[model samples]
Target: MFLLQVDEEIQIKLLMPKDATALTTVLCANQEHLKTWLPWAVEIPSVSTYEKEIIPSWLQKFADNNGFEAGIFYKNKLVGMAGLHYIDWRNKTTELGY
Candidate 1:
Protein backbone atom coordinates (compact mmCIF):
# COMPACT_ATOMS: atom_id res chain seq x y z
CA MET A 1 0.00 0.00 0.00
CA PHE A 2 1.03 3.66 -0.37
CA LEU A 3 2.81 5.17 2.58
CA LEU A 4 4.37 8.53 3.30
CA GLN A 5 6.14 9.92 6.31
CA VAL A 6 5.50 13.58 6.98
CA ASP A 7 7.57 13.87 10.15
CA GLU A 8 8.41 12.04 13.32
CA GLU A 9 4.89 12.12 14.66
CA ILE A 10 2.81 11.97 11.52
CA GLN A 11 2.37 9.71 8.55
CA ILE A 12 -0.08 9.10 5.74
CA LYS A 13 -0.96 5.81 4.17
CA LEU A 14 -3.56 3.92 2.23
CA LEU A 15 -5.94 2.38 4.76
CA MET A 16 -6.60 -1.33 4.70
CA PRO A 17 -9.49 -3.48 5.89
CA LYS A 18 -7.69 -4.18 9.15
CA ASP A 19 -7.81 -0.51 9.95
CA ALA A 20 -11.59 -0.42 9.84
CA THR A 21 -12.14 -0.36 13.56
CA ALA A 22 -9.71 2.42 14.24
CA LEU A 23 -11.01 4.42 11.30
CA THR A 24 -14.58 3.99 12.39
CA THR A 25 -13.76 5.00 15.94
CA VAL A 26 -12.00 8.14 14.89
CA LEU A 27 -14.72 9.12 12.45
CA CYS A 28 -17.47 8.55 14.96
CA ALA A 29 -15.65 10.47 17.65
CA ASN A 30 -15.38 13.40 15.32
CA GLN A 31 -18.78 13.07 13.78
CA GLU A 32 -20.20 16.29 15.15
CA HIS A 33 -17.17 18.32 14.24
CA LEU A 34 -16.87 16.73 10.85
CA LYS A 35 -20.54 17.19 10.06
CA THR A 36 -19.99 20.91 10.27
CA TRP A 37 -18.02 20.75 7.04
CA LEU A 38 -18.58 17.28 5.65
CA PRO A 39 -22.12 16.48 4.64
CA TRP A 40 -21.58 12.73 4.57
CA ALA A 41 -20.45 12.81 8.17
CA VAL A 42 -24.06 13.37 9.15
CA GLU A 43 -24.33 9.64 9.61
CA ILE A 44 -21.50 7.67 11.10
CA PRO A 45 -20.69 4.33 9.53
CA SER A 46 -19.87 1.14 11.38
CA VAL A 47 -16.55 -0.66 11.09
CA SER A 48 -18.18 -3.35 8.97
CA THR A 49 -19.31 -0.73 6.48
CA TYR A 50 -15.81 0.60 6.23
CA GLU A 51 -14.25 -2.84 5.96
CA LYS A 52 -16.68 -4.25 3.43
CA GLU A 53 -17.24 -1.22 1.25
CA ILE A 54 -15.40 2.02 1.88
CA ILE A 55 -11.88 0.68 2.17
CA PRO A 56 -12.27 -1.56 -0.84
CA SER A 57 -13.57 1.32 -2.92
CA TRP A 58 -10.62 3.44 -1.95
CA LEU A 59 -8.18 0.66 -2.78
CA GLN A 60 -9.83 0.26 -6.17
CA LYS A 61 -9.40 3.96 -6.89
CA PHE A 62 -5.71 3.68 -6.14
CA ALA A 63 -5.38 0.63 -8.35
CA ASP A 64 -7.13 2.47 -11.17
CA ASN A 65 -4.58 5.32 -11.00
CA ASN A 66 -7.35 7.79 -10.46
CA GLY A 67 -6.54 8.96 -6.94
CA PHE A 68 -6.73 7.62 -3.40
CA GLU A 69 -8.13 8.09 0.05
CA ALA A 70 -5.62 7.73 2.86
CA GLY A 71 -5.49 7.67 6.58
CA ILE A 72 -3.62 10.24 8.61
CA PHE A 73 -1.86 8.67 11.55
CA TYR A 74 -0.19 10.29 14.48
CA LYS A 75 1.88 8.20 16.83
CA ASN A 76 0.52 5.14 15.09
CA LYS A 77 -3.04 6.10 15.79
CA LEU A 78 -5.58 6.91 13.09
CA VAL A 79 -6.55 10.55 13.44
CA GLY A 80 -8.15 11.45 10.16
CA MET A 81 -8.47 10.81 6.45
CA ALA A 82 -7.58 12.75 3.32
CA GLY A 83 -7.68 12.15 -0.37
CA LEU A 84 -6.94 13.25 -3.88
CA HIS A 85 -10.45 13.01 -5.20
CA TYR A 86 -9.67 12.48 -8.86
CA ILE A 87 -6.79 13.09 -11.14
CA ASP A 88 -7.00 14.85 -14.46
CA TRP A 89 -4.21 13.14 -16.37
CA ARG A 90 -4.40 15.47 -19.33
CA ASN A 91 -4.25 18.53 -17.11
CA LYS A 92 -1.83 16.98 -14.64
CA THR A 93 -3.97 18.02 -11.74
CA THR A 94 -6.03 16.64 -8.90
CA GLU A 95 -8.36 17.91 -6.21
CA LEU A 96 -7.68 17.31 -2.53
CA GLY A 97 -10.27 16.51 0.09
CA TYR A 98 -10.27 15.53 3.77
Candidate 2:
Protein backbone atom coordinates (compact mmCIF):
# COMPACT_ATOMS: atom_id res chain seq x y z
CA MET A 1 0.00 0.00 0.00
CA PHE A 2 2.76 2.41 -0.80
CA LEU A 3 1.87 5.77 -2.30
CA LEU A 4 3.93 8.57 -3.77
CA GLN A 5 2.55 11.96 -4.59
CA VAL A 6 4.03 13.26 -7.82
CA ASP A 7 2.12 16.51 -7.80
CA GLU A 8 -1.17 18.08 -6.88
CA GLU A 9 -2.96 15.93 -9.41
CA ILE A 10 -0.62 13.01 -10.00
CA GLN A 11 0.26 10.11 -7.76
CA ILE A 12 2.00 6.76 -7.88
CA LYS A 13 0.68 3.66 -6.19
CA LEU A 14 1.21 -0.06 -6.35
CA LEU A 15 -0.88 -1.74 -9.02
CA MET A 16 -3.35 -4.07 -7.39
CA PRO A 17 -5.30 -7.01 -8.81
CA LYS A 18 -8.49 -4.96 -8.65
CA ASP A 19 -6.93 -2.38 -10.90
CA ALA A 20 -6.44 -4.84 -13.76
CA THR A 21 -9.37 -3.71 -15.85
CA ALA A 22 -8.55 -0.04 -15.55
CA LEU A 23 -4.94 -0.69 -16.38
CA THR A 24 -5.94 -2.89 -19.30
CA THR A 25 -8.16 -0.20 -20.72
CA VAL A 26 -5.38 2.33 -20.46
CA LEU A 27 -3.00 -0.03 -22.19
CA CYS A 28 -5.41 -0.79 -24.99
CA ALA A 29 -6.22 2.83 -25.55
CA ASN A 30 -2.56 3.70 -25.77
CA GLN A 31 -1.31 0.55 -27.43
CA GLU A 32 0.01 2.15 -30.56
CA HIS A 33 1.57 5.01 -28.71
CA LEU A 34 3.04 2.76 -26.07
CA LYS A 35 4.47 0.23 -28.48
CA THR A 36 7.40 2.45 -29.32
CA TRP A 37 8.51 2.22 -25.71
CA LEU A 38 6.94 -1.05 -24.61
CA PRO A 39 7.05 -3.94 -27.00
CA TRP A 40 4.88 -6.10 -24.80
CA ALA A 41 1.83 -3.97 -25.50
CA VAL A 42 1.17 -5.98 -28.64
CA GLU A 43 1.38 -9.24 -26.78
CA ILE A 44 -1.55 -8.72 -24.51
CA PRO A 45 -4.42 -10.81 -25.83
CA SER A 46 -7.17 -9.27 -23.75
CA VAL A 47 -7.97 -7.44 -20.56
CA SER A 48 -8.74 -10.67 -18.79
CA THR A 49 -5.35 -12.00 -19.78
CA TYR A 50 -3.64 -9.36 -17.71
CA GLU A 51 -6.13 -9.58 -14.86
CA LYS A 52 -5.74 -13.31 -14.61
CA GLU A 53 -2.05 -13.73 -15.26
CA ILE A 54 0.23 -10.75 -15.51
CA ILE A 55 -1.04 -8.73 -12.56
CA PRO A 56 -0.80 -11.70 -10.22
CA SER A 57 2.82 -12.25 -11.19
CA TRP A 58 3.58 -8.59 -10.57
CA LEU A 59 2.00 -8.71 -7.13
CA GLN A 60 4.02 -11.78 -6.26
CA LYS A 61 7.25 -10.14 -7.29
CA PHE A 62 6.39 -7.09 -5.26
CA ALA A 63 5.64 -9.16 -2.19
CA ASP A 64 8.88 -11.04 -2.66
CA ASN A 65 10.84 -7.81 -2.92
CA ASN A 66 12.29 -9.02 -6.20
CA GLY A 67 10.54 -6.27 -8.10
CA PHE A 68 7.68 -3.79 -8.08
CA GLU A 69 5.01 -2.51 -10.45
CA ALA A 70 3.30 0.74 -9.69
CA GLY A 71 0.51 2.50 -11.45
CA ILE A 72 0.68 6.13 -12.39
CA PHE A 73 -2.57 7.77 -11.39
CA TYR A 74 -3.73 11.14 -12.59
CA LYS A 75 -6.94 12.52 -11.20
CA ASN A 76 -7.72 9.06 -9.83
CA LYS A 77 -7.46 7.43 -13.19
CA LEU A 78 -4.89 4.80 -14.06
CA VAL A 79 -2.75 6.33 -16.75
CA GLY A 80 0.34 4.12 -16.85
CA MET A 81 2.62 1.77 -14.99
CA ALA A 82 6.25 1.67 -13.93
CA GLY A 83 8.40 -0.91 -12.23
CA LEU A 84 11.78 -2.35 -11.43
CA HIS A 85 12.59 -5.80 -12.69
CA TYR A 86 14.53 -8.64 -11.06
CA ILE A 87 17.16 -7.11 -8.83
CA ASP A 88 20.68 -8.46 -8.83
CA TRP A 89 21.40 -8.53 -5.13
CA ARG A 90 25.06 -9.32 -5.50
CA ASN A 91 25.47 -6.37 -7.78
CA LYS A 92 23.04 -4.24 -5.82
CA THR A 93 21.27 -3.17 -8.90
CA THR A 94 17.97 -3.38 -10.70
CA GLU A 95 16.52 -2.22 -14.00
CA LEU A 96 13.68 0.28 -14.01
CA GLY A 97 10.89 -0.39 -16.46
CA TYR A 98 8.12 2.05 -17.30
Candidate 3:
Protein backbone atom coordinates (compact mmCIF):
# COMPACT_ATOMS: atom_id res chain seq x y z
CA MET A 1 0.00 0.00 0.00
CA PHE A 2 1.15 3.56 -0.62
CA LEU A 3 1.55 5.43 2.65
CA LEU A 4 2.52 8.95 3.57
CA GLN A 5 3.01 10.45 6.99
CA VAL A 6 2.06 14.09 7.13
CA ASP A 7 2.61 14.50 10.85
CA GLU A 8 2.00 12.85 14.19
CA GLU A 9 -1.74 13.02 13.82
CA ILE A 10 -2.17 12.80 10.08
CA GLN A 11 -1.46 10.03 7.62
CA ILE A 12 -2.58 9.11 4.12
CA LYS A 13 -2.51 5.79 2.32
CA LEU A 14 -4.09 3.84 -0.47
CA LEU A 15 -7.33 2.36 0.81
CA MET A 16 -7.73 -1.39 0.80
CA PRO A 17 -10.81 -3.54 0.53
CA LYS A 18 -10.84 -4.15 4.27
CA ASP A 19 -11.19 -0.43 4.85
CA ALA A 20 -14.62 -0.40 3.23
CA THR A 21 -16.58 -0.38 6.45
CA ALA A 22 -14.67 2.45 8.03
CA LEU A 23 -14.83 4.50 4.87
CA THR A 24 -18.54 3.88 4.57
CA THR A 25 -19.13 4.99 8.11
CA VAL A 26 -17.19 8.19 7.69
CA LEU A 27 -18.99 9.00 4.46
CA CYS A 28 -22.34 8.32 6.03
CA ALA A 29 -21.62 10.65 8.90
CA ASN A 30 -20.48 13.41 6.62
CA GLN A 31 -22.86 12.92 3.70
CA GLU A 32 -24.76 16.14 4.09
CA HIS A 33 -21.65 18.23 4.36
CA LEU A 34 -19.88 16.42 1.57
CA LYS A 35 -22.83 16.75 -0.77
CA THR A 36 -22.22 20.47 -1.04
CA TRP A 37 -18.85 19.84 -2.66
CA LEU A 38 -19.09 16.37 -4.10
CA PRO A 39 -21.97 15.64 -6.37
CA TRP A 40 -21.69 11.90 -5.89
CA ALA A 41 -21.87 12.38 -2.14
CA VAL A 42 -25.53 13.35 -2.47
CA GLU A 43 -26.24 9.71 -1.73
CA ILE A 44 -24.02 7.71 0.57
CA PRO A 45 -22.75 4.43 -0.79
CA SER A 46 -22.87 1.07 0.94
CA VAL A 47 -19.84 -0.70 2.35
CA SER A 48 -20.25 -3.30 -0.38
CA THR A 49 -19.94 -0.61 -3.02
CA TYR A 50 -16.62 0.43 -1.58
CA GLU A 51 -15.44 -3.13 -1.21
CA LYS A 52 -16.53 -4.49 -4.57
CA GLU A 53 -16.31 -1.49 -6.82
CA ILE A 54 -14.69 1.71 -5.68
CA ILE A 55 -11.68 0.39 -3.86
CA PRO A 56 -10.99 -2.22 -6.49
CA SER A 57 -11.13 0.38 -9.23
CA TRP A 58 -8.74 2.60 -7.33
CA LEU A 59 -6.31 -0.26 -6.86
CA GLN A 60 -6.43 -0.94 -10.55
CA LYS A 61 -5.68 2.68 -11.31
CA PHE A 62 -2.63 2.50 -9.11
CA ALA A 63 -1.53 -0.72 -10.74
CA ASP A 64 -1.84 0.93 -14.14
CA ASN A 65 0.26 3.89 -12.98
CA ASN A 66 -2.53 6.32 -13.72
CA GLY A 67 -3.21 7.77 -10.28
CA PHE A 68 -4.70 6.74 -6.93
CA GLU A 69 -7.42 7.24 -4.40
CA ALA A 70 -6.42 7.19 -0.75
CA GLY A 71 -7.79 7.47 2.70
CA ILE A 72 -7.00 10.33 5.04
CA PHE A 73 -6.41 9.34 8.61
CA TYR A 74 -6.34 11.58 11.62
CA LYS A 75 -5.47 10.32 15.07
CA ASN A 76 -5.72 6.77 13.71
CA LYS A 77 -9.24 7.36 12.47
CA LEU A 78 -10.51 7.60 8.92
CA VAL A 79 -11.69 11.15 8.28
CA GLY A 80 -11.82 11.60 4.54
CA MET A 81 -10.46 10.59 1.13
CA ALA A 82 -8.22 12.18 -1.48
CA GLY A 83 -7.03 11.30 -4.94
CA LEU A 84 -5.52 12.28 -8.20
CA HIS A 85 -8.23 11.95 -10.81
CA TYR A 86 -5.72 10.97 -13.45
CA ILE A 87 -2.16 11.64 -14.47
CA ASP A 88 -1.09 13.33 -17.67
CA TRP A 89 2.36 11.93 -18.21
CA ARG A 90 3.15 14.07 -21.21
CA ASN A 91 2.09 17.20 -19.38
CA LYS A 92 3.61 16.04 -16.09
CA THR A 93 0.47 16.87 -14.20
CA THR A 94 -2.38 15.37 -12.22
CA GLU A 95 -5.61 16.69 -10.80
CA LEU A 96 -6.06 16.52 -7.05
CA GLY A 97 -9.44 15.59 -5.70
CA TYR A 98 -10.53 15.42 -2.07
Candidate 4:
Protein backbone atom coordinates (compact mmCIF):
# COMPACT_ATOMS: atom_id res chain seq x y z
CA MET A 1 0.00 0.00 0.00
CA PHE A 2 1.29 3.44 -0.92
CA LEU A 3 0.68 6.01 1.76
CA LEU A 4 1.88 9.53 2.54
CA GLN A 5 1.87 11.12 5.95
CA VAL A 6 2.29 14.74 6.96
CA ASP A 7 3.39 16.20 10.26
CA GLU A 8 6.59 18.10 11.03
CA GLU A 9 7.53 16.89 7.55
CA ILE A 10 6.03 14.51 5.00
CA GLN A 11 6.72 10.87 5.65
CA ILE A 12 5.99 8.28 3.01
CA LYS A 13 4.47 5.17 4.46
CA LEU A 14 4.65 2.85 1.47
CA LEU A 15 5.63 2.85 -2.18
CA MET A 16 3.64 1.79 -5.22
CA PRO A 17 3.59 2.24 -8.96
CA LYS A 18 1.28 5.23 -8.62
CA ASP A 19 4.04 7.09 -6.82
CA ALA A 20 6.50 6.35 -9.59
CA THR A 21 5.52 9.30 -11.73
CA ALA A 22 5.97 11.74 -8.90
CA LEU A 23 9.17 10.22 -7.63
CA THR A 24 10.68 10.25 -11.10
CA THR A 25 9.77 13.88 -11.36
CA VAL A 26 11.92 14.63 -8.34
CA LEU A 27 14.72 12.26 -9.29
CA CYS A 28 14.99 13.58 -12.83
CA ALA A 29 14.89 17.18 -11.75
CA ASN A 30 17.59 16.45 -9.24
CA GLN A 31 19.57 13.96 -11.32
CA GLU A 32 22.73 16.02 -11.23
CA HIS A 33 22.18 16.66 -7.57
CA LEU A 34 23.59 13.27 -6.65
CA LYS A 35 25.59 12.44 -9.73
CA THR A 36 28.99 13.55 -8.55
CA TRP A 37 29.57 10.80 -6.03
CA LEU A 38 26.62 8.48 -6.50
CA PRO A 39 28.07 6.09 -9.05
CA TRP A 40 24.77 4.17 -9.40
CA ALA A 41 23.10 7.35 -10.66
CA VAL A 42 21.25 6.85 -13.90
CA GLU A 43 22.54 8.58 -16.96
CA ILE A 44 18.99 9.75 -17.52
CA PRO A 45 16.01 9.24 -15.28
CA SER A 46 13.39 7.18 -17.08
CA VAL A 47 10.10 5.88 -15.82
CA SER A 48 10.59 2.66 -17.78
CA THR A 49 13.69 1.87 -15.78
CA TYR A 50 11.85 2.46 -12.56
CA GLU A 51 8.90 0.37 -13.67
CA LYS A 52 10.60 -2.44 -15.47
CA GLU A 53 13.38 -3.03 -13.02
CA ILE A 54 12.58 -1.51 -9.65
CA ILE A 55 9.01 -2.65 -9.46
CA PRO A 56 9.83 -6.22 -10.39
CA SER A 57 12.65 -6.34 -7.90
CA TRP A 58 10.28 -5.22 -5.19
CA LEU A 59 7.62 -7.69 -6.25
CA GLN A 60 10.10 -10.52 -6.24
CA LYS A 61 11.10 -9.70 -2.69
CA PHE A 62 7.48 -9.50 -1.65
CA ALA A 63 6.54 -12.70 -3.47
CA ASP A 64 9.31 -14.37 -1.63
CA ASN A 65 7.48 -13.06 1.44
CA ASN A 66 9.86 -10.29 2.34
CA GLY A 67 10.83 -6.68 1.92
CA PHE A 68 9.16 -3.78 0.15
CA GLU A 69 10.01 -0.71 -1.89
CA ALA A 70 8.92 2.67 -0.67
CA GLY A 71 9.36 6.33 -1.44
CA ILE A 72 10.28 9.23 0.78
CA PHE A 73 8.38 12.45 0.94
CA TYR A 74 9.48 15.74 2.44
CA LYS A 75 6.83 18.34 3.20
CA ASN A 76 4.49 16.53 0.84
CA LYS A 77 6.92 16.38 -2.01
CA LEU A 78 8.40 13.18 -3.38
CA VAL A 79 12.01 13.35 -2.30
CA GLY A 80 13.54 9.90 -2.25
CA MET A 81 13.03 6.18 -1.62
CA ALA A 82 13.53 3.77 1.28
CA GLY A 83 12.50 0.18 1.92
CA LEU A 84 13.25 -3.24 3.22
CA HIS A 85 14.96 -5.38 0.62
CA TYR A 86 15.50 -8.86 2.03
CA ILE A 87 13.29 -9.41 5.04
CA ASP A 88 13.16 -12.12 7.63
CA TRP A 89 9.42 -12.55 7.93
CA ARG A 90 9.91 -15.02 10.75
CA ASN A 91 11.54 -12.32 12.85
CA LYS A 92 9.17 -9.60 11.61
CA THR A 93 12.05 -7.59 10.16
CA THR A 94 13.58 -6.94 6.80
CA GLU A 95 16.75 -5.56 5.26
CA LEU A 96 16.18 -2.05 4.13
CA GLY A 97 18.56 -0.65 1.57
CA TYR A 98 17.83 2.81 0.35
Each model's lDDT: 0.94, 0.84, 0.94, 0.70
Q: Clashes in candidate 4: how many? A: 0
lDDT of 2 by residue, 32-95 (tens): 8888877777765566777788888988888888988999999999988788988888999999
> Which model is ahead, 3 or 4, in terms of lDDT?
3
Global lDDT of model 1: 0.94
Arranged by lDDT with the best first, the candidates are 1, 3, 2, 4
TM-score of each: 0.92, 0.87, 0.92, 0.62
> lDDT at 49 for candidate 4?
67
lDDT of 4: 0.70
Candidate 3 C-alpha lDDT tens digits along 1-98: 79999999999999999999999899888888989998999988889999999999999999999999999999989998899989999999999999
Pairs that clash in candidate 1: none
lDDT tens per residue, model 4, 71-91: 777876777778776776577
Candidate 2 lDDT score relative to the true structure: 0.84
| Local accuracy of candidate 1 as per-residue lDDT tens digits, 1-98 | 89999999999999999999998889888888999998889998889999999999999999999999999999999988899999999999999998
- Arranged by TM-score with the best first, the candidates are 1, 3, 2, 4
Top model number, TM-score: 1
Clashes of 2: 0
